[model samples]
Target chain A: MPIIINLDVMMAKRKMSLNELSEKVGITLSNLSILKTGKAKAIRFSTLESICEVLDCQPGDLLEFHNKE
Target chain B: MKTQTILNIMFFLAWFVFIALLIKAGTILTTFSISWFNDMAAEKMYFDLDLSMYKSYSPIHYSLIVINKVILITAQAYVALLMTELLKGFNLKNPFNHLTVRLMEKICFSILVIWVMSIIHNAHLKALEKSVGLSAEYLDGSYLLWSALVYVLAQVFKRGVEIQTENQYTI
Candidate 1:
């Protein structure tokens, strides 16, 4: 859970809606929603690559780590 | 296709066993009640398992044995019914799910209950054998092991469900 998906931020910066990003990345809207909401257990490398290509960003731009008590 | 056919056959067999066990329990219980009015009814009970001699020796033990047998048969019948439900929901595509897991647990628990009841019934018979002229021949020691195996399988199936869910959610 510490590794967070900042998919919404990347999508916003790229002026891309969730639906647009999902279409460009060839992923389902529900799956994109899951990633955006940080509910997915894992993101495949191919899927990440697709998302990064669509959003014009690196994996680091869509992911973050934080230590919390 | 072969697996589906086999599962269907097993499902039918489970229903058969369930009905058979229910009829057996019903017949024994009816005979038990009738014996109070017609003592000879106990002499020609279902399964040809005459209890007249045991009744002559001790009516309490006779009733106890009959009741125990009826309960054991009924519980086993319940397990069969649970098995039918389990097989009914058998999804070869998504075999590991919540319903199957719960039904498998129920089957295991019911079998365990039957096993414990059989143990007690056999011990009771053993204690009364010297006077009754009948040794305990009904104790199937395999029920305990079978129940344990089912319980383990249920747990494994539970793990399978977890892993499958995780996989499904791993988009």
Candidate 2:
């Protein structure tokens, strides 16, 4: 439950908006929003790779884990 | 509209017609058997009408008639639900083709069973010295079959969503 989605951080670091990332990745805005807002129960490795490739960031930069106490 | 969308629309229209028919049938049956409708007693009530006394006369019964109407109404609801889901295929992002196919097969089988059971019930009533009013055997069978089919389809749909998620990962 504590799986961290660092999408917002990555977008800000890259000086990119959600619309720009969606357009560049060829994915719908709704899906990218789901990823960014951490509403997605799971994320696909392929999608993560695409995001990393587009943003020029490592996977660790886009995801993290937090202990649920 | 696509072929499936057109079919879905037709099915929805037919569902509406069936619902109207159900209401009409209930009203007609009640009008003709007013005494039966007014009686709240659980005991079987029989009336002897002399509409055609020249020919032999028998008492009009109410208990079985009311039961039949109730069953028919329930059957109509089941059919409406089935049609609604079929129509939903047009709007669903990833319709579960396999589940829909299986549901279609079940519906066909259920209809066949209903038809056969109704014929037998009608024949049985005719042999028992009573005019066959509508019987709910067919409707009851159809409702049960469709309810089961819907339950199974829901499970299949859940699995399909999971599969879609997995495919996204592999891509």
Q: iRMS of every model, one decimal? A: 0.7, 4.6
**Candidate 1 on A1-69: residue-level lDDT in tens?**
899998888777878888887778898999888888888988899998888788788999988998787
Docking class of 2: incorrect
The list of candidate 1 runs beyond 4 A from truth reads B130-134
What TM-score, over all chains together, does every model reach?
0.95, 0.51
Please give the TM-score that candidate 1 achieves against the real structure.
0.95
**What TM-score does chain A reach in every model?**
0.94, 0.94
**Over 4 Å off, model 2:** A14-30, A41-46, B1-13, B16-24, B34-61, B67-71, B74-78, B81-143, B158-171
Each candidate's DockQ: 0.84, 0.12
TM-score of 2: 0.51
The native-contact fraction of candidate 2 is 0.10
Candidate 2 chain B has its poorest 10 consecutive residues by lDDT at B48-57
Model 2, residue pairs in steric clash: none
Expressed as tens digits, the lDDT of each residue in A20-46 for candidate 2 is 999998888888887787777776778
